[model samples]
Target: MSQIPLLDLKAQFETMREEIYEAIRQVVESQYFVLGPVVRKFEESLEQYVGASHAVGCASGTDALILALAALDIGPGDEVVTTPFSFFSTASCAYKVGARPRFVDIDPGSFNMDPEKLAEAIGPRTRAILPVHLFGQCAAMQPILQTAAAHDIPVVEDAAQALGSTYEAPDGGGSGHAGTLGRLGCYSFFPSKNLGGFGDGGAVVTDDEQLAERLRSLRVHGGVQMYHHEDVGWNSRLDALQAAVLAVKLPRLDLWGQGRAENAKRYDALFAESGLVEAGAVRLPRRTGTGRHIFNQYTLRAKDRDRLRAHLNEAGVGHSVYYPVALHQQECFQELGYGEGSFPEAERACAEVLSLPVYPELTPAMLEQVVETIGRFY
Candidate 1:
């Protein structure tokens, strides 16, 4: 159906169609589609799920990052150290609030930021470390956190791709959720994420009550009451409609997460059976014991990356390159003084990594087609 999409939201929607309609119907009938009970309920559920003291809803994930940092007075004259391998929003959000993004290279093995280089990158101006849990895998957080602690800098987690994923659970190497390991965890409800909603929305979860209160105040013009400004905050509150939609989807997240885990295992087994490992033809994803890899995208690194993508497409097997360019090399950020080979690992990943269809709704037959297509390419 639909050419075996990289991800088929329609299949997911069908499973929850009736419940989604009812959730929205209730919100619509009440005519309270703005920040209301539904949003707060979802926030409360999310906070409990992650073992955080507070969760504050916002308009979108990018704003979630912006608000988390903004509330902490992270702006001009500050540097937020992060990885160059992730989505631009990880760095762009820092820039939005006037902070400079100091990028470090990634661990070629884990596809996560290297902790060794992180300590070296911190300078006197470093205010925070924004580590992204790329592709549902958490960064090596303990070391990153320790480094920040030594310098008394806060950490904001870009757990945008990692909602139900944990770093220490069965999937990850450790015991804490990826985002919870930081001072503040920012999540996105972008349409393509594991716990996606119908539209854009996000939230910030923190163990600090003061930070939580500040986030709530910040999302709505800094007003404790309407028209009464205190802190000059932006208007970024979450809508009740999106909240209801997310709530309806949240209950099924764990089950879907399990599907992804199983899918990853299946891929591993298939690749092993096909002798690709012995041939050194495919660099499969690394699943270090620290976090649950949610398999947001079943990415593989190989020599003939573009050729493989074309062959998969010819076989009607969907695939994509998450980011063909590293954030530091992007045209807009050229003034950051980065050029070719500036962050070689990240640059190499951009050229080599290819994302394949790994959504929960994908069938075993579809997976076979995907593996077969890749085998033919090899």
Candidate 2:
């Protein structure tokens, strides 16, 4: 009769309530809500943490994407190559800027954009390549970066689920943080994200100082000075309160990620001992082991996924599909002429992928119960 939620935000907040409240109180006392000193401090701290030269705070993760696209001057006939197996905003950002989102199939093992298939997708109109760090694991960035560099296309790392994740540099120099690996990296501070704020907030990180300045200007309606328009941009400022809350939580992020990683390892061991892998009933997530992978969500490929989901629900376990439909097959993108089997890997993932409760706050007993319930179902 034990009930487990998919993400226990309350449990996490309880541990840091006093510190979080104090940060909020300081912001409230300043009475400067939008794009103020607190937000600037958070941006500087975030830039340093991500190993980027600049970080521009924005309204939300979705707004971060739009701002990135806009700042890059991607519009009209430009095309962006990206995976079909992600949240709608991944592709929708391209659409928002009046550009085309060229979809590519994902690697079934990683559930990320296939790097080998990327070359064929790039064309004359392709302006950028967006490789999402889906499920908190960095994608195959080496090959993807090579392909993008060869074609002279900018790469945007959609690190929404991968704030603290790291990947081995393509050139073998050393380890690089997820958001610092590409031309522009976007992050989310949604209430459910690993580094969740009190509400909606996001940021774009980049090494290019000029692009960073442009992103900053774009977020504040494209103005270098107040009311002086350099370009047509939208209002997308990250609030000071959210920034303060996030800054308070920022120092503890790596420890939290380590907890999630330990839990993931425990689940792997538990599943292996339970014979689920041998029985071919459930497939665990594959880790490249090249760099740090913050387990934002521990997803599995379940045979008879729908039935398994039902059983988990009946057993008081919380679960849900990360994406039930590939972005290419969405109704809004039907004009692109993609059918059911356009991206087979992504489509199959949509049908079978189930994200379990992998939050950092989960206890060993909770994880075992989750695994036992699934084992019994299969």
Candidate 3:
């Protein structure tokens, strides 16, 4: 085997080039670069797809978080509870809005904030609870929602990595998409994401009418009426050009997600057939609840991860670490008073998780090569 890249956006673009180019051409002809009809149409499409009452596009996923925090009026002297295992923006968004970020541990299986730990972390000053949908699986939202509702605290979901992931309602009501399970859900359209656009873009989805209105206003300098500022905000509007591209790709998202899921299942079968799981050499990703897991990155916990990564590279297999360090342990967050053992599970995860090539574009031959390469590594 020569090599298998971690992700191949080129392959995806090849199939949708005509549609993408035409959408961009339409945007150029319309002469609208910022939020306009194109953006509004995309937002409506996203709202219906995600089953949310409202979807507000923005500049980036990080901005989406800051907007959600600002829209909810969570600021100084307030605290937001979130996991230490996720990307920086997951916790930094709270800090950006002048709120303290209270850290919690993660579930070993799901790599998401442990709902059990969240209950003990909430305090009188806890203004919001943010849970990240890590990798491509929805976090345990049911318990998290119940905990937040018990205290009347809002939950902002960092669904940046879980665009099409689903979570079934524990009450047997029905299936709920990743972001819609909370007060607000944030998504990223970064070039590397599963539903990535041509460039940076993001959005905040919500079922609350008032919150959605606030978010829409907040994304554009907090002005609902021209030049009239209601609340202090930032310049985070999503570009119309990017929206056009996203709109063209939106219809194919479910199909692409299914491809990723199929790839994940293949990995499971291959690894199991090799007896890697039982040998204690590798731990496969697990589905924590009854939900449609859209495998954004099929990551596994390998023994001697550092050695395995080096060996994979030597074998011409492309791989990457989702996170090499936990948030609490980051030097920038030292002021938060978290030390080495603040979040043991998160720390351990940072050292062991390795994401393999699982992009929808990967062929069966590529998948076989990746598995065989890793199997030989042991």
Candidate 4:
């Protein structure tokens, strides 16, 4: 069998080649490169798709977080509470804005911030509550939101990996997309994301008109009008080309997510039949929430993860470790005074979690090969 890739953007591009080319042609003919009509139209479409009142396009997902924090005026001496299991930008964005990132441990099942631990992380200096929808599932937003609202603090969602994913309140209050559930939601269109664009691109979504306007100004160097600065901000505008490409792919996002979900189910069935779980060789990803899991990645908690990774490498099975280090344990964050046992669950996850190939383009044969390789490893 041919080698499987963790993600195959080339295969995805081939399926929509002409449509993508036409989108790019329109941008090229217009010669409008930066934020323009193309970007505005994409933002409008995204707002409707994500159920947000407004969406502001930005240069990257990291910028989306930084802009959201800056707009909220979360500067030095303020604290931003977030999960330590997420990508670096979740906490780094807070640091970039001159605020300290106070971490809350994750729920081992969902791999998201533990809502029960959220309130304790919030103190007098706390400015915002940032919860990440890690690996395409929404964080338990109901309790998180209730806690934030009680404190009058805003919730900024690091939804970079969870564009089409949703969350249903356990109380049956219905469901909402990952980004829209927060005061501000950030999405990444990096090539690996489910709804990725050609290059770096991201957006901030919100229901607040005032916050939306602030985000718009923040993306364009603190002014809607050229050269008119209301407040200092970054030049983080999303490119027109990337916006056009993303618009073309936006309509089919749900179908792609469905494909990924189907692949994940197959992997689950394969692993279950392999006796891996019964033998305690590995633990399958648990779907804790009642909402759609887009399966941006189908990760497992494997015993002897590093050795298994090397075996997969030798067998030519595509795999990866989502994060080998918790944010608090990173070299740069040493000054934060987080010790080895600060977040035991996150630290344990960093050691055991291994992501397998679950991209939309994978074939059944590829999936079987991945599982077979793991079975052989044990």
The positional error of residue 109 in candidate 2, measured at the CA in angstroms, is 0.5
Instruction: Please give the distance, in angstroms, between residue 327's alpha carbon in candidate 2 and its true position after superposition.
Output: 0.3
Which pairs clash in model 2? none
Over 192-223, each residue of candidate 2 has an lDDT whose tens digit, in order, gives 98899888999999999999999989998899
lDDT of 3 by residue, 227-277 (tens): 999888899999999999999888999999999999999999989998888
Q: What local distance difference test score does each model get?
A: 0.87, 0.93, 0.92, 0.93
lDDT of 1 by residue, 1-378 (tens): 236778889989999899999999999998998888999899988887888889899989999999999989898988899999988899999899998899999999878899889988999999989999888888888788878899999999999999888876443345777679899999999999988978899999999988888898999998769898888899898999999999998889889988988888888888888877668888899987775778777888876888888777777777889779999998888888989988999999999998888898888877777776778778
Instruction: Kindly report which residue stretches of model 4 are placed more than 4 angstroms away from their true locations once superposed.
Output: none
Model 2: ten consecutive residues of lowest lDDT: 169-178
Q: Residue pairs in steric clash, candidate 3?
A: none
Name the Cα RMSD for model 2.
0.9
- For candidate 4, lDDT tens digit of each residue in 1-378? 568888888999999999999999999999999999999999999999999999999999999999999989999999999999989999999889899999999999999999999989999999999999999999999999999999999999999999999999999987899999989999999989989988899999999999889999988889889899998888999999999999999999999999999999999999999999899999999997568999998988999999999988888788899899999999989999999999999999999999998988888888998898899999
Q: How close is candidate 2 to the true structure, as a TM-score?
A: 0.99
Which whole-number lDDT from 0 to 100 does residue 140 have in model 1? Answer: 83
Write out the backbone clash pairs for model 4. none
Compare candidates 1 and 4 on TM-score and give the better one: 4
TM-score of each: 0.96, 0.99, 0.98, 0.99
Residue 363 Cα positional deviation in candidate 4, in Å, after optimal superposition: 1.0
The predicted structure with the larger lDDT, 1 or 3, is 3
